[model samples]
Target: MSRTLVIGDIHGGLKALHQILERAEVTTNDKLVFLGDYIDGWSDSPRVIDFLIELDKTHDCFFIRGNHEEMVLRWLTAGDDNAEWRIHGGQSTVDAYQDLDIHTKDRHVGFLARLNDYYIDEQNRLYVHAGFTNQKGVYYEFFRGMFCWDRTLWETAMSLNPALSKDDLFYPKRLTLYKEIFIGHTPVTRISETVPVNKANVWNVDTGAAFKGRLSIMDVDTKAFWQSDPLHELYANEKGRN
Candidate 1:
């Protein structure tokens, strides 16, 4: 089987990301799937995006749109009018692009906007940036708020009701498709240690590398995971969040 490697939230930690990829021994034949949040939170947003773009040209790279990417896309499309983008770690992203030319800026914006919302393998492994709602048939609509921040839906589904039996767990009423959903948005302390909700269907790989956590990556088929130390301490100490 072709190796499918799923990378967690990068958040502009280029050094950490490079380390993890090196540790994972990623090759040309392996399929690399990035679980978004590629920009913001760190100091190398532009460099990270450029690296990914270049990697995409040579490797089988798949990227999903994370909440951070969505925020930037909103700013680029709407001209940062409401100032909502600034609140969600947008200032750093803006600063990253300040030195770039108009062509490069447009390229980055287009790249962010073109990211896929989700990817599902034939083996029933679902790859999404944040996650999908259990809201029946409309789950594929890519609802902005839900895609970027709907933890409640998944949480509610996992909570058992006394009225229903254990076997009668809440499943999406509209869709019968069941796959091991691999997601990254909410950061956990470990990469391999999954937040087991429904028989390990949902897995979170964001190890909070942009914050005080480590950068992580995992292989879907083998479940092999790798991580790198936090590289944001330098930025945090220097910028102090502006």
Candidate 2:
């Protein structure tokens, strides 16, 4: 049966991306929901975007706008290159774009601009680069800094006492809106794990593809996963996400 594969942050690690797709045995029928950060880490940001653009033409792919994508969109459209963005792996993306043709650069900018902040699929499975703000239930409206930058949802989930049952009122209401909530942005490496980390109903799939860890892709419904080689090994000479 066809499956929905949710991918984690891909901070310009093109080689890792390719490897994970192959390792997962992704097919044209599979729906690839990417929790974005497609650019800005390794040296191949432009190449990575180009590959994704092509992938979209051939596969069912949904791209969620990430914090990095937001920064890049601002830089492309408004000439904003604040230190906050440039220092955090954004310079590599800028350098990568410098090599693209004018039309190709515009295409990339359009792709980034069209990315959604979050996607709730038919199964009510939420896919986002970062967790959404939980006022009470799910907030569909874009909450400026929350969608692509918030970690509170994940933090809360991580703090949940596994001893409590799902029926426990101690569980946050936000988690009840969906069957599963898949996110990226916060890498699992922070917890010393190089694989997807699950807490409560939240699954963080970013295994730090831009750093020392690997790129990850998981079957959302099945919880089966695939990972690429470590970023350092994938790009032995490049300084990755810092």
Candidate 3:
């Protein structure tokens, strides 16, 4: 049977991406939902975009725009090379694209433009790079950036009381908005988790590929996952947004 795979943040670790894809035994029939951060950090940022553009041709792939990608889009369009972005892995991404031909560069810009802020599946599963905070859910979310930068959704889920049931009146309405929410951006490694972490209805997939953690891809239905070698090991020669 075909499967829907939800991937975590990549942070330009193309080698890690390849490893997990192979280990997971991905097939043409599988649908890929990438949580984004496709660029920045590691040396393969540009090549990673190249691979993703090609991958979409053969497989069903949904790309979510990450905060890093937002920064990239800004830079690509208006040359907004702010230091905040540069210090946080944007410099590497910039350097990676320095030699690109105008045509390929424009194609990448188009690709970035096409990224979705959030995607909701038929099963009521919401896939976003980060999280949404509105109690009424995505449609009512006032700031679209929340989809790619918010942490309150995950924070609330993590801090939810174990005794609190969804049926309770005190239940967080945000959690009730969707059947399940898959997000990345904030690395699970910060909480010392080496694997995907589930809190309430929110599932965090970013295993910190931008830092020292592994890249992860999970089968949303089964919750079974595959991970690559620690990114630090894969790109031992460079400091990847560390």
Candidate 4:
């Protein structure tokens, strides 16, 4: 069967990325949906983008934008930098591109620029780097940043009353916008989960590749998944999110 796999935040762990893809036995017939944060938190930020650019050439890929990717674009496009970004792993991404030629940098710029804020499939399944806040839906969201930074949507889902049905009048309207929602950005490692998390109809695939956790990918239909070894171990000698 042609599986649709939703991947979590990569956080520049190119080795883990490759290992996870292999473990999952990804085929060109499958649809790969990346939840973003392709860079930062590791030494292979530039190479990760390079590999992804090539991967898209042979397979169907959907790249969603994450908060870190947003910062990457800002730095590459307009030289925007802040202490927060640096301390949070942006510095690794910035340093990764330091020696690149303008032509190569421009190509990376195009790649990151073309990333989607959110993606919805024909099955009414939503894929995003972060959660959306608009009760109506993603299209009606006012702050574009919310697409890659909001946590309330996931928080709301987690706090949802299991006894309450979607038909209830008090159910969160935002959660009702899609049949199912998938997000990253906020790592689930913080909650002590190393696997994909499911709450209500929302699935969080970000198992925290940016930190000491593993990189994960899940089949949207089967909920079956494969994860790489702890990213910190993959790049033990280097410094990044690990």
Candidate 5:
């Protein structure tokens, strides 16, 4: 079987991403899927996008839109008035694009604007930047609190109300059509291990790489995972500065 390699939040760490792909021995046959947050936090947003554009051209790569990408699209389209974009590591993103040409900037912005919110494989594996809420259909339209929000709602429902957990919140019977759900956005301390939220069906892979946490990758077929140590040195001084 071909491998579907899922990568976690990049947050502009192109070096770490390259290292992980090299370590994982990624091949052209494998379908590489990026969970989102490809740019922001780190110092190489422009380079990261450039690299992603190159990768997409050469490999079967799937891109999903994260909250960061949404903010970037908003900034590019509507201008940065809300100030919400800057709070979530937009300054670094801006810094990265400072030297880029106008045409290059426009191309990257257009790429972000065109990103899909989610991807569902034929095997029933749902890949989204953030996991879905109890809300049933039309999952992608409910973007306000979807892509970057925590899974606390589902966790609370699972713990406080077993009856509610037994409902569609924990394990959506309709989702039985898919094999698994893979997501990122909410940062975790470790990315190699899968956190089973709904009976081992849903997995969170953000791994908090942008915040000096691990950079993670998962194989879709064997479900094996690989991770690199926290790139703490890359962002040690930048922490809390933003």
Candidate 6:
């Protein structure tokens, strides 16, 4: 059956992205949801965006806005060049666009601007670039900012006692709100292996393609995953925004 595949951060690692897609055997029948941070780390930020644009034209694809995309959009539309974004890998994206024509550059900006903060499928599976803060006594929409920057959500899930039943009164309601929550941003390598990590129904698929790991893609329902080789090997000689 065609599956709904959710991919994690690309971070400008075009080679890894292509490899993971091929490894997953993605077909036009599948629905692909990207968890964002598409630009920044590797040497082909512009190329990555271009590939995504074309992929969207040919398949069912959803793109979520990541902090890096937010920073770059701010720079493109509002002229706000935040240092934090630059230090975190935005420089590679900027450098990649230096030679592009205004039309192509604007297309990139338009694509980035249209990214969603989070996407919830009919099955109540939530897909977000980062995690959302379930502010006590408030609706989730009010804390949308958390969807793109919250580390606490993942950290809290990681800290939870694994033995608790889903119905345990003590189980976090925030985590139970959705059947499953898939996120990127915080790389899985920090917690365990260089693969997708699951904790408290939250699956983190960002295997750190921007840093030292590979890019990842997972079937939303089956939890089956695929990854590229370590990004270092993919782009053997490049520094890759390090």
The models' CA-based lDDT, in order, is 0.71, 0.87, 0.94, 0.92, 0.71, 0.86
Candidate 4 lDDT, tens digit per residue, 108-214?
99999999999999999999988888889999999999999999999999999989999999999998889999999888988889999999999999998888999
Model 2 lDDT-worst window of ten: 134-143
Residue pairs in steric clash, candidate 3? none
- Give residue 218's lDDT in candidate 4 (0 to 100): 95
Estimate the Cα RMSD of every predicted model relative to the unseen true structure: 3.8, 1.4, 0.8, 0.9, 3.8, 1.8
- Backbone clashes in candidate 3 total 0
**TM-score for each predicted model, relative to the true structure:** 0.83, 0.95, 0.98, 0.98, 0.82, 0.94
Model 2 misses residue 131 by how many Å?
A: 0.9
Query: Which one wins by lDDT: 3 or 6?
Result: 3
Q: Which stretches of candidate 6 lie over 4 Å from their true place?
A: 135-139
Regions more than 4 Å wrong, model 4: none
lDDT of 1 by residue, 155-214 (tens): 544443436543555644422455577777776643343322132356677777656677
After superposition, the stretches of candidate 3 with alpha carbons farther than 4 Å from their true spots are: none
User: Which ranges of candidate 1 are over 4 A from the true structure?
Assistant: 81-84, 135-145, 153-166, 169-176, 190-199, 233-242
Q: How many steric overlaps are in each model, in order? A: 0, 0, 0, 1, 2, 0
lDDT of 3 by residue, 198-230 (tens): 999899999999999999999999999999999
Question: Under the 3 Å rule for N, CA and C atoms, how many clashes does model 4 have?
Answer: 1
By the lDDT metric, which is better: model 4 or model 5?
A: 4
Query: Residue 229 in model 3: shift from native, Å?
Result: 0.4
